[model samples]
Target: MDFIARATAIVGGTMVLLRRMSAPAAQAVGLTPTIPEAKKQGIMTLKMPTAKGWEPGHKPTAAQGLKVNAFASGLAHPRWIEVLPNGDVLVAEALQTERPPTSLMDRVMQATMKRAKAIGVSANRISLWRDPDGDGVAEVRKVFLEGQNQPFGMALVGDTFYVGNTDGIVAFPYEKGATKLTGPGRKLVDFKPGGHWTRSLIVSPDGTKIYAGVGSLSNIGDSGMEAEEGRAAIWELDLATEKARIFASGLRNAVGTAWEPVTGQLWTVVNERDGLGDETPPDYLTSVQDGGFYGWPYCYWGKTVDDRVEQDAELVARAITPDYALGGHTASLGLCWMPEGTLPGFGDGMVIGQHGSWNRSTLSGYKLIFVPFVDGRPSGAPRDILWGFLSEDEKVSYGRPVGVTIGPDGKSLLMADDVGDVIWRVTGA
Candidate 1:
């Protein structure tokens, strides 16, 4: 980082929030889920206020021939988001994973307004939002998939919308142009949603196979050192055959996966393990090779082994890690590769949602970043393309971005903020 950039960050860091409010809901869903009964207090819904010395928001305006607008607002923890054929969106809220409900004592707290209502988790479902008027806003949003575990990733294949639940995969006969879902489909696969279980999925461009990423069940393989039944791997399911097998392995957790239109190279953003004391292994965005390994608990960031887990530093020195380290704990997820060709406006660009940071002392990365790529490869380091969701000093300003997509209208961009349960669009005005 240059001096000016570094200095800007120092200014920005001051505003980062040091206190904890409502935890980044998506991160909680992806990592730890404590039983509500075990906790003495209710889940926090407070938005941590920004720090007094935080940097100012450097949010960008849509380039010429481009416009950005807020499509909808008032959402609750919008997690994995997918665009539908008829200009609608399918989203899952990781509410079901909100620790098992508490007991009578917890109920007392609820009655006293100390906790949220309902002991049972309603998070196990997906919701649909539609912008029928096409006025650059979602006028309606309703539940589409229900009774789920931790419904996260979603993909549309013809009439079937594949929903990735914490425990498995299910297909629903999703209807377009409708604000509600009332039908059920079939289950494609049953999975073990554990340690690292935020499933991100995509269908092959040709539409024959489905690729779903399942994160590690252990912090690194060491937690489950012995059990390897589908831990830390991306599995490919033959859409025509319904058979699933490991597609790639050793990725601690690859949250976002997309195919570069110009080159068809696979790209991903992975969440490397934590507890390496804040600076060890860096999370990354890289082109994933089929049958290749981006070492997890064993290595990271161009083959740097984590000394905490791997005893032999020599082995860590040899492993191949990710191509681009997206800094530590930025929590990059839901990737979208830009336009078809090498246009000046976008140099084979990619957009990643940096879902903010926890586990670290000060807050960082709760916005969108642009990773410019060319000729099917990264041309340079990522720059904060879309920022300001988190306050200048560390408090959340507007909302946390979970997913990014081209609007159903095909001209603008849509970003989902999980906390607000809202969808905002950036389009040509």
Candidate 2:
């Protein structure tokens, strides 16, 4: 190994030893997670499992009352999913765009991501999957759109279909039951792409607007707050006017978004800032308020300041506490509202597809989980819906779950497994 690689190895070894010496803190999960003191490190904990895909006939283990099957396979880094009115499923297949490492930390992160199958060339396309027979598996697959820049989110509003590319939102004309879109799309808005580039799109209940989740450009304004402008928050786009504005700010990386059926409020799952021990600031699920700030580099979990960033007393005072904590470094990326009876024994709740963690000694998430909600607020503890994506020893990952949605049938669940390159469907046993 080169000098830098050798140095990284030595540092990694020391971190592992230190982690073992200090026992892991109690898990921070649920509506009231015990936020621990911040323990900053020059080099954050880096323990990523090698990505070893599943063998033939292998699949994730579903919950006791549910059965799992590969709805579609052979995808190229499928990361997000959208279901059409005609019961066809649309999947966005893309990965992070490559940029040369500019620093030692960048090099280390790039190498680690490669080992975890998180780095790759973007497929830059969206494909359609149709299950006409209502059988668990999809028999028809077609490339619906292509030649796009790192697309992640798709929304069909009226006759216009919208795509959330890494750099902007693009819209194309569409027809009901149509299999492919051939027209060149028009750009609706621009976004600074690169760091934390996945833009998740969701349409409003009235179909008059769209919400896009844009993540931060750096871990904690390390590149200066100016570089993070128009990012790390959700943008509301007026469909009629084709203009967008920041809806909520101060979220480090809010990736998934959904609307609460009862309250008519917007909710999101946010990936918190890193380098603060293994369980200091937990990834969260919260009801997003219009014009509300949730504290990104300035503070966390309400007014608790992160001392690392230059103090912003005014902003910290206004930071809204999240509604629920989903565990630290869990990388929760996909969120969808699951109405009662959609899945067996799963009531009105949100299904989150945790992409899993790479910055902790022990892995946190690599499966699908459900957080029950009563009267539009999260209630009970989270329950595992599907697991076994990681090996028993936790050194190898067979898959990483990403975007999740209710399947076309309205009774099943569909999850995108990017590492496994398969769209899994979950149904009642």
lDDT of each: 0.63, 0.91
- Give each model a TM-score: 0.76, 0.98
Q: What clash count goes with each model?
A: 28, 0
Worst 10 residues of 2 by lDDT: 1-10
lDDT of 1 by residue, 1-429 (tens): 134334433433442333233223222211111111111112211223222212333233444444555666545566777887766777777742334334642333233221111122446667777887778777787877777777788888877778787677888776656565567668899788755668878889999888888887766665455664686778898989899988877788788888887788778888876554333455777777777766766766655555556454554555555667665567787688766332225555788887766534445567677777777777665655456666555533455567777667666667766654566676544
What is candidate 2's CA lDDT for residue 217? 95
As a TM-score, model 2 comes out at 0.98
lDDT against true structure, model 2: 0.91
After aligning candidate 1 to the native by TM-score, how far in Å is the CA of 155 from where it should be?
1.8
Off by over 4 Å in 1: 1-68, 100-122, 175-179, 310-318, 340-344, 395-398
